[model samples]
Target: MSKPPLIPFSTTLFVRDTCLCLHVQRAARALARRFDEALRPLDITNGQFSLLMSLNRPEPPSMSAVASLLAMDRTTLTAALKPLERRGLLETFVDAQDRRLRRLRLTETGERLLAEAVPIWKQTHAAIDAHLGEAASDRLRAELLALT
Candidate 1:
């Protein structure tokens, strides 16, 4: 059999430096870590904080609504709800008008916890925005929203 040629190392370097998906993933992970650390004292992960925050609405949100906002599938959203439910931070119940649908809402305890988390989130977020500068941060957010 004839030997096959290997891909050039320069090609590897090019992708490493210029791949948008790779860069975005790396930045997302770093941001998650930063937020996770900031929220550590509250015993919540960044994902948990976001989930709890999403439930803060005038009326409870349907499972599909919450899932869509979080960009998660039903199964994944359901699984994520379990820990918070167990903690008495939130509740999920069958919809009154539609027995087959589930709706989620923050419990009183969840609201209190989220209240404590907000200042921490604000401080951490402000620091990050400062690092990026006001204009760059605004532009970056606009670009990210455009992508989604």
Candidate 2:
């Protein structure tokens, strides 16, 4: 086949500079790195911290609810839960009222670890907010929520 027409270099530059999805992904990865580093002393990834925090509730939440809140599929959430479960940080059990539903809860160990992690998370978040300025940080959160 004949060679296809090449996309112009300027078009590539335009997309690189202006693509919202690309920018968001880059920012997310950077933020994840920052949080991961901050949480590393606790032997937890940023994702795990978020997962554990979600499980802190008066009643255990259904697996589907946690998955939805985390924007993860069931299988991915299940895989993510395995490490925490193995560590005895959280547990998954069949719902008492609904045998078909599985629910998740943080164990006492998980709760304590999460409690410790909160200060670290808060410190990191405060630094980030300060860097962004409180108003800008709030606006960015609002914009991100709107996108979601």
Candidate 3:
């Protein structure tokens, strides 16, 4: 089979400089890495911490609801839940009224873990905000939310 032509270096530079998605994704990965390193002592990743925090609501949320809130698909959310569930950090049970529906709740352990993660999150977030400057940080957050 014939080989396909490679993209030009100029195209790479253009995408690197101008692609919003690329920039956002790169920033997201770096931010996630920072959080992951900080949370390593707790044996959790940034995504896991976020997942657990989302379950901190007053009532257990259905799988679909949690998935929607996390901006994750059902399969991805379910996969993410596995380790936490195995650790007894959360539980999933069939809904009483709807057997086909499953709901998620943070266990006592999960709550405790989340409580521990809160201060760490606060510290890291504070550093980030400070680095970006208070006004810039707030503005950046507002702009990102607008995108969503």
Candidate 4:
């Protein structure tokens, strides 16, 4: 009798079995692409949108605070703020009480941009909810947030 054929562990099998990371990454990319396309007229990326939203709270936040909120390190956050700062969307100033600290503020331009972007963001958000259905999407978002 012939021996039974053995299955080899190929890259494809490995990827298929352990590809949740890839699937999540691809989904994030797709979602970002959709948001980018939708926000193009406003000239904002999703990251920027998030940053702007973070700064839209009642009080101005410190650099470290904003970085913590965004789950980004100080260096990465600094780099990300460059374009927004250059565009007059945000400004960083030395803290009055703590000279060593830098505070992030949304300029008038930033506020205006965010106001314009809100409707675009709403449309993208609505489309996603519509595609996934409200309950499922909400539950998925809750799960994802929990993981984060």
For model 2, which pairs clash?
Answer: none
Give each prediction's root-mean-square deviation over alpha carbons. 1.6, 1.8, 2.8, 3.7
CA shift of 18, model 3, Å: 1.0
Q: Can you write out model 1's per-residue Cα lDDT over 72-105, one digit (the tens) per residue?
A: 9999999999999999999999999999999999
Q: Cα deviation in Å at residue 147, candidate 2?
A: 0.7
Query: lDDT per residue, candidate 4, 1-148, as tens digits?
Result: 9775586558678997789788788889999999999999998999999999999989899999999999999999999999999999999999999899999999999999999999999989999999999999899889878888
Q: TM-score of each candidate? A: 0.96, 0.96, 0.92, 0.90
Root-mean-square deviation of candidate 4:
3.7
In angstroms, the error of model 4 at 67 is 1.0
Candidate 3 residue lDDT tens string, 49-111 = 999999999989999999998999999999999999999999999999999999999999999
Model 2, TM vs. native: 0.96
Cα error, residue 60 of model 1, in Å, equals 0.4
The full ranking of all candidates by lDDT, starting with the best, is: 1, 2, 3, 4
Model 4 TM-score on a 0 to 1 scale: 0.90
lDDT of each: 0.96, 0.96, 0.94, 0.93
Q: Could you tell me how far off, in angstroms, the CA of residue 102 lies in candidate 4 after the best superposition?
A: 0.5
Clashing pairs in 1: none
Order of the predicted models by TM-score, top scorer first: 2, 1, 3, 4
Instruction: Report the lDDT of model 1 for residue 86.
Output: 98
